[model samples]
Target: MSKKPIKRLAFENLTIEFGDKKIVDNCSFEFPLNRKIRMLFNNDVNKYAVLHAFTQVEGITQGKYFFNEDDVTQFSFEEFMSYRLNMGIGFSTRGLLHNRSLQENLLLPLMYHKMMSMDEALEHLKKFYEYFDISSVKDRRPAEVGPNMQKATLLIRAFIHEPEIVFLDNPEMLLSKGLYANLLQLIDDQVEKGNLKHLFFSTEDEDLSDCIADGFIIVKKNKFEFVENKKQMRLAV
Candidate 1:
């Protein structure tokens, strides 16, 4: 018999409601361990709510989810933390502190897990800083970096943790149209080199369709559709 590949993450029959509005409706998908994916949605999908569903850090009104093949409904906070350790979650607010250095902020998450030594964690941070081309700002405070650099640094923060699946919640939200292409190119290089599988979503991007592994689903009026980037050919950057 052939070996069954690990089911890295999934959302099955997920539906979330706020008052009478169903922000997410009966959504189902899988994140395989070795694949990179981009999820594109416009105004109606409630992007952050979809983001919350993956972590189960936010409560869902009705739905089922799994992380690394185990049901999320059965996990305790400790279990959830353990799950997080196995899968690095590099959220937007993951890095930086008002009074701390970028390097220090990067180490805080690893220290919170209590699994890596200080030296090991520092070395990891250093590598990501170099990989993402953010070493100059790594020593500087986030407030001191330029707007575009800040966004790139956030990506660096994500990459440093070595996440099997990273969620990029519009890290490029503040960048200009030109910078968008550069950031994507840099990230594509990093993903190929670092062996990362990630999910990113954006409302106004023109180039992500070609630069990343794209999978689109639009949820409006409680309906869903799977979109293919190639099918969106006439669209231009």
Candidate 2:
């Protein structure tokens, strides 16, 4: 078989601070794109901060962020917007548009970035609607849905565009253990197809990391580091 391409997304001595409070200290690490990696966070605050960093919504105080060896430490809003099409980001249901139905929200990315017609977008959604369980409730607005359906909507929004890389920010935060397990299996199945790369950030324990993650990232004491031994991750805390 031909060798798979090697892709790198890294943070070089990156520092993220608010005023004098350092959220994530000077840290550097690369996410291996050959496998799905789980970034473990002890608290909710740091987890989302890292997601914002990936999306360039929050700027770092020092150091550089790189994608494919290109410096992207200080991307402008417009630049980042254009860049995010190849990147998918998942947020809490709170991030979903309250006034729009799930179908409309899912169609936005395909319409905006891919320039697909409304009918075409809906047709495309048919491909993965069952995977996310959003087809039945796709017409419901945020207020009309429960947390499970809302979370499904968020997943649809993030993945509808079929971006090369996906950043899932606590995708299972609102899910039950069983449902979350199913989600993990689904993620592994998708990764096995070698079409998408995933970086999952969650406050859950290391047990979840062992499920399908090929590597582990630990964010502790205001710094980020990779855990060499995936087995020691649970005790690393």
Best-fitting candidate, scored by TM-score: 2
Task: Write the residue-wise lDDT of candidate 2 on 165-226 in tens digits.
Answer: 77777677665565666566556656676656655555354466566577677776456666
Report the Cα lDDT for residue 76, model 2: 70
Report every candidate's CA lDDT. Answer: 0.59, 0.68
| 40-126 per-residue lDDT for model 1 (tens digits) | 555776766766656555646666777657777666767576556544444544445757767766777778766489988877677
RMSD of 2: 4.1
- TM-score: model 2 vs. ground truth: 0.84
Most accurate candidate by lDDT: 2
Per-prediction TM-score to the true structure, in the order listed = 0.75, 0.84
List the RMSD of every prediction in angstroms.
4.8, 4.1
